[model samples]
Target: MANIQDSAQQLEEAIRNSDEFQNLKQAYETVMADEVAKKMFEDFRNTQIELQEKQMQGQEITEEEIEKARKVVETVQQHDQISKLMEQEQNLNVLINDISKTITKPLEELYGAQEQ
Candidate 1:
């Protein structure tokens, strides 16, 4: 377990130093440097958090709330900086997902259903 923990820490460091993470950080910084884009992103993020919290609580999110989120997304999509940031974010997400799959592949193979 200690060895696993050490390896996990090393993996985290490697991820932090990866080009995908660096690109995402740069894109995030560029978006944050623009005041208008920053404010818009904050609002969108807040709304998303609220919606997620409500869902977690088994509460219904109103259509108006959904529409508000959609409008915010549409507005943000119009900005090149925000667009680049989103693209970088998606790329980072894909990288993370790939890492997760790689790490779990052995267990999956061991317990996976056998094909007919």
Candidate 2:
């Protein structure tokens, strides 16, 4: 277990140092450096969180709330800086998903082989 934990930590460090993560960080920093973009992003994030919380609490998300979120997304998408940041974020997510699949492959193989 200790060895597994150590390996997990190493993997985390590797991911932090990865190009995908670095690019994402750079893009985020670039967006944050612009006051207008930063504020817009913060506002969108806050609204998203509120919507998520409402959903989690079994509250209905009204059409107005949905339209508001859509407008925020549309506005952000129009900004080149935000668009690049979003692209970088998506790339980072893909890398993370690939890593997850790689990490789970051995377990999947073990179970699959036994069933065969």
Q: How accurate is candidate 2 locally (lDDT)?
A: 0.93
- Backbone clash pairs for candidate 1 read none
CA lDDT of each prediction against the hidden true structure = 0.91, 0.93
Q: lDDT by residue for model 1 over 1-116, one digit each (tens)?
A: 46988999999999999999999999999889989989988887898899999999999989999999999889888988888999999999999999999999988988786744
- Each model's TM-score? 0.85, 0.85
Off by over 4 Å in 1: 113-116
lDDT comparing candidate 1 with the true structure: 0.91
Kindly report which residue pairs in candidate 2 clash with one another: none
lDDT for position 13 in model 2: 100
Which candidate achieves the best lDDT against the true structure? 2
Quote the positional error of residue 72 for candidate 2 in Å.
0.3
lDDT per residue as tens, model 2, 4-115: 8899999999989999899899999999999999998888888999999999999999999999999998999899998999999999889889989998999999989989
Q: How far is 28's C-alpha from truth in model 1 (Å)?
A: 0.6
